[model samples]
Target chain A: MHSRTSFSVLIFILLIWEILVNLLHIPKFILPAPSLIIYTCFSQAPLLLENTLVTAVEILLGLMISLAISIPLAIVMFSFPSVDAAITPFLVISQAIPIFALAPLLVVWFGYGLLSKIIMATIVIFFPLTVSLHSGFKQVDPDYEVLFDLLDASFWKKMRFLYWPAALPSFFAGLKMAVAVATIGAVLGEWVGAQKGLGYLMIQMNARLRTDMLFAALVWLSAMGMGMWLLVGKLEKHFLFWLNDTKN
Target chain B: MLRVCDISKIYSDLAVFTNISFMVEKGSFAAFLGPSGCGKSTLFRVIAGIESSDSGHIEWEGLKLLNLKENTAMMLQKDLLLPWFDILDNVLIPIKTLKRDTKTGESEAKRLLSRFGLSGFEHYLPYQISGGMRQRAALVRTLLFDREIFLLDEPLSALDALTRQSLQKEILRIQLEFDKTVLMITHDIMEALMLADKIFLLSHLPMRIIKEIDLSNLPKPRYHLDFELAEMAENIFFTLKGELINA
Candidate 1:
C-alpha cells in the first residue's frame, strides 16, 4: 500500500513518455516508449529470466564469498595491530583501483566464467564489510573492556561475546552498502567477458540495435538489486532486532 | 583484605598519580574521594589489573593482584550494560566467559534479580529499562561473579538524587550480605561519608592522598541532615577547596 504512490508516479511518467513518443514521432530504436519496453519485457520474458538467473547467482555468490573472507580478515586485523598496520595500506590501494578497470584482469586470471564475475562482486563488497567491522571491534566501549578484564575474560571469549555482538550494527550497515553495489560489480564482469548474464545480454541487444530488449535487461538487473537489498533489510531486522528504533 | 601500596601511573612523560597507598580490610567499605580527573578511576583500573601502574604493588591476602584479575569486579560510573543483551544474559556474562554451568548461572541470576527487586524484568533490554534499573543490572552482573573485592568508580553518580540515595542503601546492604571488600570512588563528600567506613581524600592531578578520614564511629542508617556527618563533610570541602587553590 505504501508503494502505491511511487507506482502511481511511475505510471504518470510512463503516460507522459508514451504521449511524447507518438506526438513527436521519436524513433523507437533511439528512445522506445514505456509501452514498447513493457511489451518487450513480456515477449522476451523467458530469455530475460535466464540471463537474470545467471546475474542473480553471481551477485549472491560474490556477497557470500565477501562475507566469508572479510569477517575473518577483520577479526585477524582486530587481533593483531602489526598485521593491520601492514595490510591496511594494501587494502586502501586495492580499493583505490576502480573495480571496472580490474574486471578485465580478473576475467583473464579466473577465466571468462562465473568465477570472474563473483570475484568482481566480492572485491566491490569486501572493503566496506571489513573496514566497518574492524572499526566496530576497535570502537567498543572502554568500560565494557574494563568489565571484561575484571571478569578475566579470555581473548577468545571477548571476541565471541563482546566484540561480535557490539559489531552487529556496523556489519549490517556494511551489508546494506554492499548490496547497493554488488549488482554493478557483477555486470561489469559480464561486460568485460561472460557467456551468460544480463550484462552480456544488454551488450548483445545494444549491438543489434534492439533498444527495447536492452531496457528489458536493465529492468531485470535493477529488480535483482532491489531483491538483494530487501533480503538484507529482512535479515537486519531479524538478527539485530535489539537495535532501538530511534537509532534508525 | 586488599592493600594498594605506593602505586604510581605515568602516561608518556606525565605522572597521573604518585605514592598512592591505601588498604581495605576484609568486608570493609572504603571511598577514594577525589576531584574529577584526579586519576581515581585509573587507580581503580590498576587495582583491577586492567592497566599496569608505572611503579607499585597491589596485593590481596598476601598475593599480588596483578595475576588475580578474576577475584575483582569493577562497576564503572556508567553501568555499561550490553544494550543487546537482556538483564539475565547481561548478568550471566561472567559465568559464560568462565565457562560455568549455564543452568546454575541462570538460577543464580534469577535469584539475584528477585533479591535486588529486579524480578519480572529479566527479559528487558538495557535500553528498555530506566537508568536506575540499568545500574541495578550492572550490579547484578558484578555480583554474579562471586568476587571478593569490588572496585566501584562513582557507580551512583549518574542517577537521580533519590535513586542515588536508595542505591547507596542497597550498596550498604550488598556489602554486608556478600561480606566483600568495596573501594568506591566519588567526588560527593556526603556519599563518601554515608557509605565509607574510611575515606581517602585525594588532591588534584599528580594525585596523592590529602587526608584520610576515619568514620567508623558515625551512626548507622545515617540521616540526610546529621550534624556530625555534616560537620565532617564541611571540613573536607574546605580542605579540598584549599587543595584546589594550591593546585
Candidate 2:
C-alpha cells in the first residue's frame, strides 16, 4: 500500500513538472524534463557509473575513518572528564571553518586525491558522532553505576557492560546523520579539485550546459544517500530489536 | 559471622548515623526496617562496602573488612540487569567480573537458574521477562559468585503484591537451602515480620536501631498466619511510628 501511494505521488509530481515546462516555455538547459534526464543517464551510463563508484568509495572510507577515530575519542572523553573538557572547544571551533573554505586547503595539503575527499568526509561526520556518543555515555542510569561500584568492576568492565550498550542507539542515530553529511562532504571535496567523481562530472556537465547529465549525476547522488540511510536503518533494526519494541 | 562496631556515617553537616553496632550469625536472616530516607539503604551500602563509614570498623571471621575483600553480593531495589544481556548472561556477570573460569562458572550458573525457575528463559533479555522474573535473575546473579553474605536492598519492592509474596517465600527457601547470611533492608513491616529472624527498626535521616523484634517463633511462613502475625505487624508499625516521631 505504501509503495503504491508513493508511485502515484511520483507520477503526479512528473505531471506537474511537465505542465510547468510546457506553460512557461522554460529552456531545457535550465531544467531538463525527467524523461530527458533518464535518457542522458542511459547514454552516459559508463562514465556516470565510474564516477558514482569513486564517490561511494570516498564516502565509505571517510565514514570508516570517522567511526574508528570518534568512537575511541568518545570513550576516552567519557573515561576522563578532563579530556572532554579539553577537546570540546576545539571540536566546536572545527565546525566554524566552513567546509567550502576548508575544501581548498584540504586539497592543497593532501594533493587532490582520495585522501583529500576522505579527510573532508571525516571532518563532516565525526563531530555529531562524538557528541551523540558522549551524551549516551553520560545518560547511563546512576543505579547501574552503583551496581558496578558494589561489584568492584574495573573501568573496562564498566564500559563493556554498561557504556557501550547504553550508547548504541545514539551511536546509530549519529551514523545516520554522519552518512548524509559524508556524501555531501565527499562531493564538496570533489568539486574543489578532482580528476574524477560525481561532483566533478556534475561540474563539467554544468559548464557545457548539459543540464540533463548534471541532473543524472544528482539523481545518482541522492540514490547513494538514500541507500546508505536504508542500510544503517536495517542494521539498527537487526541489532537493536529490543530498543524498538520497548520504545513503542 | 560479621560484626559491625561503632560505625558512623556523616554526609557534609548531616549525620546519617552515630555509633551503630550489630552482629550477624554465620547463617541467619537479619533485616533493617524503617521509613523512607531513614538511612536503611545507606547503612546497607556501608555494610556491603560500597560506601565508607566515617568511623568504626567491620570485621568478618576475625579479619578486618576495611578496604578488604568481603565476598559479599548486593541486590539493589532495581534489578540493574543489563538490557543487552540475556538472563543467563546477567546471572553470570559476577563470575565474569571476578574473572573466575567460565567453564566451571557456566555450569554453576545453569544449575542455579534452573533451580530458580528460570531454565527456559535463559536467553531472554531483562525487558522480555516480567518484573518477578527479573528480580529472580538478579538474585541468581548475586548468588553466582558463591558469596557468603547477601545484602538485599528492597529487592522485591517493585513487584506486585502477589509476586512480592511469592518472592518472599522463594528468598526464604533459598536462604535456608544455601545456609548463607542475609541482611535485607525494607520499609514493609509485614515483610520484615514474615522473613527476618530478627528485625531492626531504624529512625529517620540519621538512622539508628531503636527496637529489635525476634520472629523465629511466628510460623514457618509468616505471611499465612494472619491472626498471630497481625499482632507482630501492629507492634512493628507502632515502633516505626514512634521512631519517626522521635527523630
**Candidate number of the best DockQ:** 1
* Model 2 lDDT per residue over B129-211, tens place: 99999999898888885878888899988899999998898899878899888999887888887888888888787778788
lDDT of 2 by residue, A1-248 (tens): 99799989989998899788878988999988888888888898898999999999998988889989998999999999999999999999999889999999999999878999989999999998899899999999988887777678998999998888889899999989988788889999999999899999999999999998999999889888989999999998887887986786
> Given the true complex, what DockQ would model 2 score?
0.58
Query: Going through the candidates in order, what fraction of the true interface contacts does each contain?
Result: 0.79, 0.59
Worst 10 residues of 1 chain B by lDDT: B63-72
Model 1 agreement with the true structure over B1-247: per-residue lDDT tens digits: 6888888999998799987887778888999887888888888877777888878788888887553476788898899888778889999998898888999999999999998889999998888889888898889888988898888989998999999998999899989889989989988899998988899989999999999998777766787698888999999999999988888
- Candidate topping TM-score: 1
TM-score quality measure for candidate 2: 0.94
Worst 10 residues of 1 chain A by lDDT: A239-248
Record all residue pairs in model 2 with backbone atoms less than 3 Å apart, i.e. clashing. B16-B206
Residue-level error in angstroms, candidate 1, position A74: 0.7
Q: Please state the CAPRI-style docking class of candidate 2.
A: medium
Query: Which pairs clash inside model 1?
Result: none
* DockQ, computed on Cα atoms, for candidate 1: 0.72
On lDDT, the candidate that comes out on top is 1
* B16 Cα displacement, candidate 2 (Å): 2.5
